[model samples]
Target: MAKIAINGLGRIGRSILRLLTTTEAGEGFEIVALNDIARPELCAYLLKHDSVFGLFPKAVSHDDSGLTIDGTRYPLTDNPDLSQIDLSGVDLVLECTGKSNSREFATRGLRAGASRVLISGPCPTADQTVVLGANDEMLGDQQVISCASCTTNALAPLARAIDTAFGLVSAHMTTIHCYTGSQPTVDAPRGDLVRSRAAALSMVPTTTSAGRLTDLVLPDLAGRIFATSVRVPTASVSAIDMSFQAQSAVSEKQINKMLAALPAPIFGTTTEPLVSSDLRGRPESIVMALPETHVTKSATMARVFGWYDNEWGFSNRMIDLARRMTSM
Candidate 1:
């Protein structure tokens, strides 16, 4: 089995470990080490009990030495600098620290002896930004790979499907995302003006990179996509409302058919109507909102809806990509 290490223990990082220790999806890999600014005990405590995912089903305990789960006690290093951490025997490092999305910081993992470094969010310096169903096939020999943001993953399959059936002309996305850790619980002074307001009490509109990242992932659609986000009070799941102009005529039936036909583990389809809450723990990258999909007059305008458990779904893909990187 390939040995892996994880850096950062935030929402995504914690979710990654929760899955690795509690599910079979973690097979073929072993978590040898973890690095974060938090204390080991805090990391261990948070891992066992999460507000969104609830308590992990497995036993987790920690001390100053390290974290123990599933009969293994992996070493924990409390440092931000990658150079100080011991990564001996680690084949891959999941860089969950959002700060390492740049090429220079991402390359530090490689210099530290990791065969591959998988970043959790968008990485401009990455050798490739991979969205599972859209372009993971391009992961070739890349030492640094980005699993793009949750919004990017949720939008990629739709872009690919639309481009495949009806040539896409221009696209826009309005994501109704849940509040994140960065937002203040109550009104507080901050660099970003809108984000300083209470997180749970307001629907704060903000900028997003999904549209631009989509262009990067699908060069054919470059300069044709735009996106924005609104952070709501909800705790977990996020919804994507996409409207795009297409070159050819299309129908709701065609969109449904395309979504239903998407490969497993990447896209999931359901005829039963679903709310954002229903997708809280879903593992797929994107789940089609079958009943809400629609097309405009002349079939030139199309609207699609997708729901994703931003934390878990993206973590699932991260786990899958980490395993793939190990093989290379």
Candidate 2:
């Protein structure tokens, strides 16, 4: 069994803990410790009652000593500076603290004796950025590996499929993402002008690094893709709108067939006109919305839609990547 530690108890972090304790994916891995900024009580409360995912089994609880779930207790180190934490016996540290997507932060885990550090989002300084089906083959013995952002996870596979069938000329993606911890429920002052507005009552547009990160993982698609983001009022799940020009003729039937044939854990396709709420807890990277997929008369250009439970899917991928790294 591999020993693991998680930093941060936010949406992604809690989701990771939730899966590790309640699902089969949690097997064969032991959570040695956890580091976060919240008080032990607050973290436990959030874990037990997640507004988006609903209450976890009553078994989830915590105290000043640490968090307890699924018959295991993990020591909690409530600090933002990871360098001060004691990570003895930890084989991997799943760094979900969005703030630690850097080389310096990754090194902290390694220096503290972790065999590897798996970050939740992409980091240019990390040794490798594994996007599962897209470039998991490139995973190496790097001390630091990134499980690229939720958007990148959802986009890379589609980009690969489109590029394989019809050469990608250029692409633009707009992610209709849900409000996150970074955004406030009511209008509040923030350094970033757009994010300062109320997240629950507005459709706020913001920038996304997913396109740039996607290019890093799939070098062939570099400079050919761009992305924008819009933060919606919803609390969970997200929709991605993609428009692209391909070198070959396109047809709905062909595109549908292509997405339909994608392997498990990567994508799933459906013709139903489903709402974002319908995918609240799915673990697939993306679920192609066949009914919304459109193609130009000439088939050289097309539009595609995909929906995902960003928090749950991304957290699941983090565990999968961590396990793969330990196996390697």
lDDT of 2 by residue, 1-328 (tens): 9999998888899999999888898998988889888999999888998899998974867888698886678899787777787786788999888876567877788877778899998777888888987998899898888898999999988898899988999999999999888888888998889999999999999988789889999998899999999999999999889999999888988888888999878788778878999999999999899989899888799999999889998888898898898888
Candidate 1 per-residue lDDT over residues 1-328, each given as its tens digit: 9999988899999999888888898888888888889998889888888888898887888878689896789888887788677676779999998887567898877777788899999888998999887887788888888888998998987788888878888888899999998899999987889989999999999988898888888887888888999999999999889999988888899878878888878888777877888899999988888998888876889898888899999999999888788887
TM-score of 1: 0.97
Q: Once superposed on the true structure, which residue ranges of model 1 sit more than 4 Å away at CA?
A: none
> Model 2 — TM-score against the truth?
0.97
Evaluate all candidate structures by whole-model CA lDDT and list the values in order.
Answer: 0.87, 0.88
Model 2, C-alpha of 92: deviation from truth (Å): 0.6
- Provide the clash count, candidate 1: 0
Backbone clash tally for model 2? 1
TM-score of each predicted structure versus truth: 0.97, 0.97
